[model samples]
Target chain A: MESVGELGESGVLGRVLARMGEARAAVVGPGDDCAVLRVRGDAVVTTDTMIEGPDFRLAWHDGFELGWKLAATNLSDVAAMGAVPTALTLALAVPHDTPVALLERVAEGLDAACRVLAPGCGVIGGDLGRAPVVTAAVTAIGELEGRAPVLRSGARPGDVVAYAGELGLAGLGLSLLFSEAADADGTAHDRTIAELWARHPEVLAAQLAPAPPIPLGPIAARAGACAMMDVSDSLSIDADRLARASGVRVRLETERLEGAFGAQQGVRVPVDAMLTGGEDHGLLAVFPADVELPVGFAAIGSVHEGDGVRLDAAALEPRGWDPYTVRPPGS
Target chain B: MESVGELGESGVLGRVLARMGEARAAVVGPGDDCAVLRVRGDAVVTTDTMIEGPDFRLAWHDGFELGWKLAATNLSDVAAMGAVPTALTLALAVPHDTPVALLERVAEGLDAACRVLAPGCGVIGGDLGRAPVVTAAVTAIGELEGRAPVLRSGARPGDVVAYAGELGLAGLGLSLLFSEAADADGTAHDRTIAELWARHPEVLAAQLAPAPPIPLGPIAARAGACAMMDVSDSLSIDADRLARASGVRVRLETERLEGAFGAQQGVRVPVDAMLTGGEDHGLLAVFPADVELPVGFAAIGSVHEGDGVRLDAAALEPRGWDPYTVRPPGS
Candidate 1:
């Protein structure tokens, strides 16, 4: 296997770029100093980073899956803004000894995700450098298409809170990976990964390569969503943030959550997991009480004239992953 | 100093965001899923990454300088496309024990660069994560303001080649640091950085925090520049690339180069340094011979009906930094 150092930057870059598809809005694509994009309306931009230790483990994540997750995660943020994603710029750095094939696979995965999740959206520009570990930073751009952005602060007291895409399955998948595929000391390994995947393919796929409903963002906006945000951290944590931002309280009914997300692809997801599972990349939205929920969205709660988040009549603590404070086991 | 791990993600994010200034084009700033920008015309996007060990050493680079360089480099790329920079997104990852104050300084530096280099451009959104070393990836977006982007392949025969901003000073500074402020084994240290900075302030500043003539990009476009690119890797190498892309030959005159950039800011730069120096972040442009050069630009060469690059009829080999192949000493 040829390493990046052996093939050199240009060599690896050429191969990696060859795998990328053209973005519909890109007037000038890669190889130039910058990629020029045609914007129809207001532009929305978001960025996210995934590092080796805290974000993923090479032992469990394939390059394709890593790249897919990177695209999906940032695309979800764009979707949460009720915009159409147009382009992604990636900044990837890895150790000198990293295989060039890994980068090619990553590009393939990124292209695949864009085609499947957000058609016509693609990687437009990026940079490649050397690092101590695999590090990827993705910046996604979206077009609002003449509509007002669905800000988190727009939720009203009489709005119905709804959720779309995966909810707790991702968090459950993460738990399963740590418990079954990791050593006793918490170090991740692939020794049982095949067996684990064979037994629980849905959870593993949900965690490793999420396919968030990207198109539903515009649909929900058109359907009269009052406020929206990507449920990246967790339903409870992100809901609390939206509630505080909107000066309202979010009351999630247990029955609604279970009814909507209890059995995702044959995987039983408990209400607790739905509240606290991270990396779901789903959309949490609020709409007027009179408005109908979008086809892909299910009503899970309601907004009330109060502060913070609640589970029915009980106050729910906002607990989720904090990058600085949360040290992944064995990392 | 309080470490990031102690402050937690949101706590550190709040302090860091407090230091950022507002972007004029921003409709919605940080704290949301994405930053919304009211773009006037076509948007140009670019991304770049800097990682510890390979890109820079903490011993010589203060947090502020590192952040400033990160913004400057990416902004230069946006400028190269004849666009007015609008916003920046930074993805920063650092060790858990890293000081929170350092991150605050980084934000301050980013805000300061946007204000000084490209007013109205500021950090809009970003992500924070944990890594083994300090890693920063910055994506800059610029609005073309309805003008067609100046591309590298637009140069034609009889066009005059020009250069603007710092020429060889940045590369001279890098050489000076490696020779004076680094140990024999190539490990960088700050013990002698103060003395070196005092002796060669211009070069050090050029290398550490280049203020590339970003405004000149739009100026050149308005002045009828046929082709343009930022001189990031070296005049020789980038000139060759422009020539190849344009399907023409670039003939650089030594006397013309000496007359324009021999004594930039009182530093007598050798012709060789101007040819091979990297990280100048200057604009290299080609304009019709009949058009007047932009105020900050000086003609140094001319396009010919041939291929490759030349120096007064002598063939010049293109040479510059390759991140994967070039191992910084002591790193």
Candidate 2:
């Protein structure tokens, strides 16, 4: 896995895309030029941004990767919403003396990503200026084929809670990066990421690149996902969110999850990570009890009559990484 | 006009958004705690960020405004795209010893903004860490009514180039604070930011608090705007963008611009700032030759078959403010 703070730059995105599922409105998702969504109308608008050190590391990710990631991250959001992404507006703040080439690469990555993921969406406007660190912001819009949207608040009690994307790879990879940073040697190493990284060379890619389920979000929503949300946070946290929004308790069937997801241990984070670790970009969804979901979803949890989070029999703790409560690497 | 960098936190944003036209999708924008867009789909997504030296003034802006602005800025973008923003993800980097109250205010701002804009969006996911300065990245996802989005490149030649928002107040207000770094007097200007600001308080207000035309973008687009763009950059620069993207040149009628624009200038920057300034957040659009534009738009320019820019009859030589070619401020 790429180190949280010192991860390398290139070749991490592909792996992230390989493991992600598809949403309906999204014609394209991660690893593409841009994540394309089908907007209801002809007009499409989009935006993007990059943060200084926290979003990336100068050591592990390169300028180019950061560029691609920044654009990919925002494009994913638009994709998740089922809008046809048409144009992007970038708000960039960087150090005064940053290398021109680095900025160019970042721009290049943005352009390249748009071309691949969502050809319909083009880079139309960008804001560039000086700052102490490099940061970018992007926002994207898409067309929904004139359908009712999919929302997290729409789930109900007895809804079949399912997931259409990878569970905990990013959380696990991020943890590995932090642990490695704490490791005196600091050489990048993650059993799951190494294997996947070599093949796709993009496993930890999930950690850095953030391959969003651009199309799957709308798809799940349209496929009768009563309630749906992107799992950019802890599974337990997001589940709790869905539960709270739907006014129900979510009883995640640990046994079913164990049966279906234990094989990928490296990617399979600690249950705590699975419950609370963030930034996986997966989707947690609730569906009608009887209707079969679209092709990508795996049912591992069910909604119940309760409050907050629960795993097996016990109420889960809100232990996801928090800025006020958690201590990140190199802080 | 506002500077790209000035304005104490939300002040700059307020300036940019002050004169924007409403979109059919936007339930709220900028002035609200959180901006809302009508969602065509069930789910809405959004993002926001805080820049240290630029978006926030270490000497001027407070932590709460920082947080609020971080969330609001991104939410504004979502509104611009005609999406009802839901859920926010943040990435923050700051010194370990940063005051907890400051962070709390930032969170409070986030919470407040969400409560106002998209209660559903709230503080869903975020990453917190350390850096020399404080910076926050927040992304807001919005849902839009089943309508097509408005794009910056959609304007056609011969379309009346009009705007649904004001221009250059942010730049004007920013000028008051631009030289604060070099001011040897070191007067206690930072202590009372409210009073010792610019002469044209409205102009400065535009810089500090931009009025985004949340509803106007989609409206203008649908109203036969050949093209539509947010006036984050100077009207001139952004207009140039429309021209280049549309494969046409724009003839900005300075007299008409003078009659329509607020903040009457003396000798300098009337035309220059109007044309080349940044952060206005106005809409620059082109419409069919005979079509009537929506309310708030006055014809300030026309799109002709040419390359680059023009002011009246003269060839508008860009002063390096083009999206891809702007020189660093100090340079």
Candidate 3:
């Protein structure tokens, strides 16, 4: 296999660019100084970075899965804005010894994710450089299509709090990996990966390559969602954020969460997992009580006149991932 | 000084976001899923990455200069599209033990670059993560304001090729640093950086924080520029790309290059540096022979119905920096 060092920058770049399909809104795509996009309305831009060791383990994540997760995570942010994702710009830097095929797979994954999750959204323009580890940054751009952006601060009292897409399966998948596929020191290995996948395919898929309901973002906005956010760092943590942003209290009902997410894709997900598991990439939205919930969204909570988040009658502490403070299980 | 690990992610983010000012096109700024921008016309997007060892040396570059360079490089891409740069999204990942002040300085520099280089442009949205090295990716967005984008393929046989902003100085600065400030093993040290700056401030400034003629992009477009591109990888390399893209030959006059850029900002630059020096971040544009050159643009060459780039009568070989193939003088 040829490495990036052997193939050189331009050769690797050509292979990566070849895998990228054209975005519908891209007037001029990759190879230019900038990709020109035809904006239908307001433009929404978001950026996210994923680094090896801290963000993902090469032992556990295939290049394709890593790229897919990168695209999915950024695309979820655009969706949370109630916008139609238009394009993505990826900045990828890896060690010189890294395989050129890894980058090609990453590009294929990025292209595949865009095609499957948000059609018409594709890789536009980006730069490739050298880093000590696999460092990928994706900036997603979306169009509001003339509707007002659904902001986290837009929810009010009497608003119905809803959830869409997968909930806790991703977190469960991660837990299973750490427990079954890693050593006591938390060094990840692929010894049990195939077996883990075979036994927990749904959870593994949710964790490795999440397919959030991206189209539902604009749909929720058109259906009159008052506010929305991507649930990345657990439902409880994000709910607390939305509550604080909107200056209201969010009360999540236990029965509703269990009933709606108890058995997702044939996996029994506990209520605790739904509330505390991270990397779900699902949407949490608020709507007026008088309006009907969007097709994919399920009512799980309500906004009230107070502050912070509540599970049943108890105060829910916001806790999940904090990049600076948290380390992976071991190294 | 407090480290990022000590302060945690949110605390570090708060300090960084505090330094960002609002962009004129920003409908919503930081502290959201995405920053929303009011687009006036077609939107231009670009992304660039900078890694610690490969792109810069922390011992030599202050955090502010590093951040400023990051913003400047990406903004040049937007400007090359004949668009008014409006916002930047910065994805920054640093080691856990990095000083919080470094990040603060980085944000301040990003804000200052926008204020000084592009008045209405500002940092809008991005994420912070953890990495083994300091990795930053910036995505810049700009608006065309209804003007047709001046693409690299638009140059005609009779078009005049012009260069704007600093040329050759940045490459000279890099050479100076490698020769003087770095140890025998190419390990950078600040032992003589102050003295070097005192003697060669012009070259150092040009290399460290280039102030490319950003506004000249739209001005040149309005003044009838037929083709435009940001000169990032030396005059010869980028001009060859432009020539090939347009299916025309670009003949650069040695006398014109020396006359216009030989002594820029009180620095004596050689013709070789002007042709082969990289990271100038200047604009190279093509205009109709009959059209008047924009104020900051200097006519340096002309286009002909041929292929590749030429200097006077000889074909010029395209050579500059290739990230993968080239290493610093030593380790």
Better of 1 and 2 by TM-score: 1
Per-model TM-score (chain A alone): 0.97, 0.75, 0.97
Tens digits of per-residue lDDT, candidate 3, A194-237, equal 99888999999999999999999999999999899999999999
Candidate 3: which stretches are off by over 4 Å? A321-331, B321-331
* lDDT against the true structure, each candidate: 0.91, 0.56, 0.91
Model 1's CAPRI class is high
Model 1 residue A31 lDDT? 91
**Candidate 2 lDDT, tens digit per residue, A241-295?**
7677678888887777766555443544445556666776666777899979787
Candidate 1 lDDT over A1-331, as tens digits, reads 9999999888888898899899999999999899999998999999999999899998888999999999999999999999999999989999999999999988998999999999999999979999899999999999999999999999988889999999988888888888788776777899999998899999899999999999999899888898999998899999999998999999999999999999899888889989988998999999999997879999999999989999999999998754334444444
Choose 2 or 3, whichever is better by TM-score.
3
Candidate number that wins on lDDT, 1 or 2: 1
Query: What DockQ score does model 1 reach against the true complex?
Result: 0.90
Categorize the docking of model 2: incorrect
Ranking by DockQ: 1, 3, 2
For B36-117, candidate 2 gives per-residue lDDT tens digits of 3444443333333456654557665555555555655665555555444554545555665666546655676666655554
User: What TM-score do all the candidates reach, one by one?
Assistant: 0.97, 0.61, 0.97
